[model samples]
Target: KSPQCTPDQHLQTQSETQGLESAQVTKPVEETLSSLSALLISATANPENVLIDALDRKVAFLVNFLLMKYRMKELVRKADIWKMIIQDDEDHFHEIFLRACEHMEMIFGLDVKEVDPTRHCYGISIKLGLTYDGMMHPPEGLPKTGLLILILAEIFMNDNCVSEEEVWKVLSKTKIYSGQMHFIYGHPKELVTKYLVMEKYLEYRQVADSDPARYEFLWGPRAHAEVRKMEILEFLARVHGTEPQSYPSQYEDALRDEE
Candidate 1:
């Protein structure tokens, strides 16, 4: 879709920019930039026929100008869009284009989302929004099993490890264990194990080679990508009035006791 700005609006903006009456012969830089942004958004939404010449000289020049004015190189690094607009040794300009995407909140970043627990799979999500909801509930696509795994990860954030038995104990403390302990197809705890293993959201390794080997769980790639230590600490501080400073000491004690 084209830009929603009317011709009159564009003319007024152009006139303001030039301090002269708008002319039909020459388009103002502001109008060009707005049109470029609209085209980019449209291209993003329509992958099959995306405009390939988005990096043409005119668009590139405008993108570079905007980036330099905003000073947003670091956010571009986080968004990870270097390959899109990179040309020759013009790495600096590519980063600006990327940072613009992030600043607009059109392409925020990767977030891990659990899609199916019974099938044991997860999906990568693009985080997009101006406001955060605070991690009160599991993210939209996360399954119940994924939620349990995430809770276990947060609980063992300090030590970075938990035994299978300890995980069960933590799960038991939840209301699900008391009143609702079953899924339609199988048990809830088993679903948690399957989901975590399938998605690699939690690592499961045997402690020994035995008939019934004991296992330990650790945060996996998805967990590391999505959850942060500070997030867990902040959540605990808000919920339990727990001091953030106490975590390290408590974690140390737990580690020693585990040993």
Candidate 2:
């Protein structure tokens, strides 16, 4: 989830140098990407134990971005006006997402592709789960990782699996700016850093589309309410399991209640 800046007023010029856009934006993503060359050279073991330090230098830029955007936020005097413009759900989030993609392409090794908002939901849902909250339109109220952590939970809660395709499709939607060579909102380097941070919980699982009906139904503004009801009941019923046998009985009982 995106962290709220300390405040536009609190940010200082010294702090701006610490943010994400300083170097990685100017250099190649691989140049900024972590490598095991040093670790490999130092190792005596037959097989080098090279740990991939994804962010070796990523945070320097991300922090700066937050600060840059924070200062920009301060330039606007109207509090409500700022809220409408910068909230995660607003189009501004998309702008950030687009800028972020600029850095993501190089760091994460993504190829350009078209994103189907429905299919892309998996990855977007994961990131946004951490950013915007269903309960709180502005999750700035939550802990630093609160929105981020909950997003990891909500996204992986269903199945602990992420597909590269899912990630690629979503990243495809971001706009790449030529000038900064990073996200207009933040750094691309954070793609690897944030992914590394969230990876432990986001183990990918295969989502099956065995049924034609299941494939046909996904996200929609007017999704079938009855189907949604069944999904809620079924998901809840599945969670009620203590043992395999009793779960069948619980499922039946739950279905009856839903009916």
Best by lDDT: 1
TM-score of 1: 0.37
Instruction: Give the TM-scores of the predictions, in the order they appear.
Output: 0.37, 0.21
lDDT of 2 by residue, 1-259 (tens): 2122232244354234322221212233323222222322333233335443323222223223323333343321223322533443454444433443333333322212333444332121112112321222122211122212222222222122223332332223333221223322233224222432343322322235432321111111111221232333333233343232333433453355367
Angstrom error of the Cα, residue 161, model 1: value is 1.1
Candidate 1 structure lDDT: 0.40
lDDT of each: 0.40, 0.29
User: Which lDDT tens digits does candidate 1 get at residues 1-259?
Assistant: 1112123354345434222211110122224334444554554554476555544432444344333322321222222223444544364554444444322221112233335665534343334211221222223221233233234433344245545665554444332242354321135454555555566566676654534777666766665556545544443443344565555644454445345
Candidate 1 displacement at residue 68 in angstroms: 43
Looking at model 1, the pairs that clash are: none
Model 1, stretches more than 4 Å misplaced? 1-146, 154-158, 175-180, 183-186, 209-211, 249-259
